[model samples]
Target: MIKPTEKPTVTLVGMDGDMLGTLRCVEKALSLAGADSEYLLKYQNEIIKDDLYKDYNRLLDVTRKYVNVRRLSREKDEEEREKARQQRRGERAGEDYKESGFES
Candidate 1:
């Protein structure tokens, strides 16, 4: 049996079409966005308002909301599953159950 302190995480994603995979961690993704903005500095004609960081910030804001919602939905699902399992096991609050003896 194996036990872990934290639940498993999906780290890698498939790359298809215009998508080259993306980071699951928002902070790290934002860091990469900052790097993108820094790279844009090489373009002398680029304006500060056109910086990609701001765009990334906006997108990440929505991403953060989406991530939170998904996490919450997953947590609720896990809780419901656990409750169902407990019910199936005849384990309920202040209740007692005995298994039927029908040995073959």
Candidate 2:
């Protein structure tokens, strides 16, 4: 899995610093665009038919594995965060129960 530090830091830009779209990588963008060829063609023609798209495509080719790794890493991080949060909640509940002084 791609570490947070290892993820690519590229962002697609337009004329005068206007943001076009945020791309994780080429494969990610294509996946998001969906499996329909018509849709893919339209997207290429409408949104990515420019020098920026060319650069994104090149980057995607090089970083496809890195993108997948990053995705897995992110999912793992989220799961860990959730487990920690749940543990904290359980501990808080235990403390509350003790403070309530409900004898068995």
Candidate 3:
């Protein structure tokens, strides 16, 4: 049994036992099995909307995680840039002081 977290694709089984059209069926099955109905509904609004809802929430969570990772990367880049800027300023200051006849 695929967990609700799996985001498994739903496929309709035909009368001949062959697969029919896919319909986000997993979420619907979960809903029919008495999973979170309202949350699923709020997440999606189609047939087997609940199944789609579960997939939607899962996707949102993955997106949030990626966003956090990107934010951290930006912060690291800023820190590196600042460090380089500070080093350049120090080098310029040292040159100026040396040219002012200051002792080594």
Candidate 4:
């Protein structure tokens, strides 16, 4: 079986609808916003103090304009692999039949 070390990544877009970095960074940033009233309140204060929240709003804006994508599964690749495996099996069976002087 063929396996990939990492999942496929999607790209993020900027305010100008230009390509940004990988979605991994975006996910990391969102995860850093830990939950809790104090943390949330502190975040609010920081947002108000330096307009940090605007970046999230910018992200939302981009999301509204375009679809966000993610890797659902590696099943499609696995299916292709199964097809290749079946082809190899068929070839081997055909070779075996030829060697045995039998119609298969």
Candidate 5:
């Protein structure tokens, strides 16, 4: 049996379309509201506000979604690995049985 730690690590980066749309709306609102701001300001505001600055509920929801996605992906990877391992075991067992003159 392969240890969990022996499995290759999977990394995922997800961006919610709704979250992106909300950001675009925010940017458009800011742009229409007053003088143009620096690109860095927009980027900083988006990151800080999403992760740290504001809307605790929204942050939790996004975090939950991200975590769920990663969890599902990892589960799928493990399932595939298990299936492959089982297939190899079956093949080896079949070869052993044949070598023992157990043909039917």
Candidate 6:
């Protein structure tokens, strides 16, 4: 439910459960990030290289409702996992999942 934001954090949280919603949310986020469509396209071609844009299909995964396709990348995946591990070991006391950057 936490739509991805334009903050300078590692993850962009604006993905909706569905493609259409996700697109809209991502567009809004990009807009808020102060990027126009053309700028974003250029950035995608430059900053956001192909490695971070991997396409993953999860149509058979019943647990997922809002999303089926996702971007799979090893770097971000490991970083988030490590953060989660640290949180489990009690990094930030009384912090919620979102506050601890665990919501995806």
**Candidate number with the higher TM-score (2 or 4):** 2
User: For candidate 1, lDDT tens digit of each residue in 2-45?
Assistant: 22222223222221111112223532333343433343232212
Q: What is the lDDT of residue 96 in candidate 1?
A: 38
Ranking by TM-score: 5, 2, 3, 4, 6, 1
Candidate 6: list runs displaced more than 4 Å: 1-17, 40-104
Error of 2 at 23 (Å): 27
Model 5, residue 90: C-alpha shift (Å): 0.3
List all candidate RMSDs to the true structure. 14.1, 14.0, 18.2, 13.9, 16.5, 14.0
Regions of candidate 4 where Cα sits further than 4 Å from its true position: 1-73
**Span of 10 residues, lowest total lDDT, candidate 1:** 12-21
Q: Cα miss at 22, model 6 (Å)?
A: 0.2
lDDT of 4 by residue, 1-104 (tens): 22222322333333222223422343333334332345334433443565434465554344332223442235655676688899999999989989998764
Per-residue accuracy of model 6 over 19-83 as CA lDDT, tens digit each: 33444444455556565677445534532354323331222131122223344356777787888
3-31 per-residue lDDT for model 2 (tens digits): 33333333332222222333424334555
Between candidates 4 and 6, which one is better according to TM-score?
Answer: 4
How many clashes does each candidate structure show, in the order listed?
A: 0, 1, 1, 0, 0, 4
Top candidate on lDDT is 5
User: Candidate 3 vs candidate 6: which has greater lDDT?
Assistant: 3
Instruction: Estimate TM-scores for all models.
Output: 0.21, 0.31, 0.31, 0.30, 0.32, 0.27
Candidate 4's displacement at residue 35, Å, is 52
lDDT for each residue of candidate 5 in 6-46, tens digit (9 for 90 to 100): 21222232323345544444444444434255742644454
Taken over the whole model, the C-alpha lDDT of each candidate is 0.36, 0.46, 0.44, 0.44, 0.47, 0.43
Segments in model 5 whose C-alpha atoms lie over 4 Å from true places: 1-72
Model 4 TM-score on a 0 to 1 scale? 0.30
Error of 3 at 101 (Å): 0.6
Candidate 6 pairs with clashing backbones: 3-14, 4-13, 4-14, 17-66
| Superior candidate under lDDT, 4 versus 5 | 5
